[model samples]
Target: MKHLLYLFMLALPVVATAQKDSLAGAVQATRPLPLYRPGFALMLSAGSTGGGVAVGYSVSRSVAVRVGANLFNYDGTLKSGKDTDDIQIGFDYTVKLKNADLMVDLYPFKRSGFRLTGGAYYNINTVTFFGKPTKDVKFNDTVFTIDEVGTLDGKANFNKVAPYVGLGFGNPYTRKRLKFMVDIGFFYQQSPLVTFRTTGMLEPSSDQGSVIQKNLEPLKYYPVVNLGLSYKL
Candidate 1:
């Protein structure tokens, strides 16, 4: 009995060491591992920046790049009086906004869903102010030609390449296949070039293009807000 009791006591340390090593291995196996595969995503968005679809490619787990196109249009009428005559003139206006862009997003926190974005946008936008006399203007008791009465036609050109900055939510890829996103940003662009043209007596008014340009000074900056959904591929 004494011999058996001594042998059991001597084996205790060996058994305890084996159990400790087994527990350590189990804990190490449960830690999350980084995925090394590349991924892609498709997104649809809408807001002041316009509505469009974008495609993204993952450069790495926390970085991505994308490209997209967007468009918007507006139509309306405007009225003004001729400088030399008391007759009123009317014009039909068409405003168009178009955009093409490339952007990069950086996800700084692996555990959080926030990102910072920067990009460049090329805008092909124009505003046309135009109208013709529906009926001949009775000026000084005589009717006038579009040239004599003056055609109210002018175009404002906003051909610009601008820089953008913004903040957003969502990863280029997620643990699951789908994710929700939100972005708010601004585009920095300068004032546009304007041209005014006419025929007949009012042709001299073309020189007033500078005055027209000043009236449109408030339209230089563009605001953007977007809500989007993305699917991984």
Candidate 2:
């Protein structure tokens, strides 16, 4: 099954590009294969307060891959000023996956030398919750606050693999100097629930599953965006 999945992934580019090249000199027909562009980008996410930075190179005209890290709150409740400050570090793998945009670029503009990029990424999410949430909140004999228990488990662990698309607007005629672009994409992460107890209580009063599920409710993955400036050699 895994082999089949890998094969399917590898075959996509051939299939898409082949179709484009076969038709009446389409966009794929006009563009050169293995066109290369390399650059850096600053990443900001709705998941966390601070942003992340990434640097990488592109080997293809329509597809690129990069690695980056950013501070993100997996749960909606944690995104605010308090809860736990957690950050994620991971690598991303992307495929143009879709080339309709490349076709769009070939027309209306007579520019022959330009690079278009789109792909996906894999992000390994690691989170740390500061202290515990249940130390002060009393819950009968329950030793730990539900929030604290949730943080120890559900909030602190997970991984996310997401796909993204990017469009480039510049003159390849200038020969790799300076180019600016903005990109938007989407991704998601899920953490496993853990159990913990309150300092003052005796019984285990919190469930990580319920707490994490509730906390992450508000954070929806949509339009993961990036704003970048690139220099190609």
Best by lDDT, which number?
1
In model 2, where do residues sit more than 4 Å from their true spots? 1-118, 130-154, 165-176, 190-197, 217-223
Q: Which window of 10 residues has the lowest lDDT sum in candidate 1?
A: 31-40
How many backbone overlaps does candidate 2 show?
14
Clashing pairs in 1: 91-131, 92-130
The alpha-carbon lDDT assigned to residue 134 of candidate 2 equals: 28
* TM-score attained by model 2: 0.42
Per-residue C-alpha lDDT of model 1 across residues 116-176, encoded as one tens digit per residue:
9999889887888975554456666787665566576789987479788999997747565
In the range 176-209, model 2's lDDT, one tens digit per residue, is 4555544443543334333333332222545434
For candidate 1, what is the TM-score?
0.70
Q: Give the best candidate by TM-score.
A: 1
